[model samples]
Target: MKRLVLLLTFLCPMGFIALNAQSSSIFIGATGGANLSKFKFTEDLKELYPASNSLLGLNGGVTIGFEVQNFTLHTGLQYIQKGSEYQTDNFEDEQGTGFYSATEKLHYLSIPLLIGYRKYL
Candidate 1:
């Protein structure tokens, strides 16, 4: 299942380029970046978790674009991960308790399609 999706993601662009090869210019590139994810809480919640910090994440993807004259079409597939970590002060209750901590991690699959027109300077 995964392989099929990956194959299609790459092949679909090739198909477009092949069909437009005679009249359009083809562009293929790789993209990557860093992400800092953080969580903000309200006044009441902030008091419970005094120690909050941003988590580091990474993203990377492939890009393909076709240009015909001043008009262009582009698309890409990307994988992104973003999340945050939270920690709370220790609290006492009827039962013995320890400090509380939580980590959230989210994953995303991104597909962007774009059309563009260029202006000559």
Candidate 2:
């Protein structure tokens, strides 16, 4: 728990730095958007696994972005998690009172890159 607190302490501040970097070219603003949730089954199979976006349903959050040259980078704090349900079909009873359910709380940070168009007034 302490390690997680330590890591988040450093990482969240990095977001603050990204907000303050290059005052001339960088502008920070709040953003919200749709996000997909996925789970990690292994480290080497990020591309191979069928990413289940519907596992935890839709998610939304606020983000901060900065413009560097023609590229804009966005980082967000998201409320999201991976979830699942377990069930079995049986000839004895199609509908059974016996079923299992579980939920996990998740917290995450997201980052994205967006190409930018600039206009001066």
Candidate 3:
């Protein structure tokens, strides 16, 4: 749910750019990057628990584009890994009191499309 929203937040601008692009010469390229992410719990959860730590992740993909003069239209597919490390100290429940550590990971397939116009000074 939240993840989906976050994904869309990241992709929507690119989609809007792609839809508005005015270019036609094709070009191909590769893209890769590392991402650091953390879990952002809801207010309800935060009231009762500590925030989680960020985890390092990686993303890689291929990009295709169309260029016309100074303008370009681009699109790509990427593999993304998002994760976080969580720890709780003196966590108490009906069972008992203890410390806990957990790691979470999620994988996503993303497609980003955008248009760019470059100018030289």
- Clash pairs detected, candidate 3: none
lDDT of 3 by residue, 12-98 (tens): 787557655754567899999999999998987764458589999999999999776777778989899999998777577566766
Model 1: per-residue Cα lDDT over 71-106, one tens digit each: 777899998989889987665545667677789888
lDDT of 2 by residue, 1-121 (tens): 9999999799868755765774535455554455445454566543343332334444556666666444466666654444533232221334565432334445555655454556655
**What's the C-alpha lDDT at position 99 in model 2?**
36
Q: In model 1, which regions exceed 4 Å deviation?
A: 1-22, 42-47, 90-97, 119-121
> What TM-score would every model get versus the actual structure?
0.64, 0.36, 0.71
Candidate 2: where are CA atoms >4 Å away? 1-56, 89-121
| RMSD (CA, Å), each prediction | 7.7, 9.7, 8.1
Error of 1 at 112 (Å): 1.1
Better of 1 and 2 by TM-score: 1
Clashes of 2: 0
**Worst lDDT window (10 residues) for model 3?**
15-24
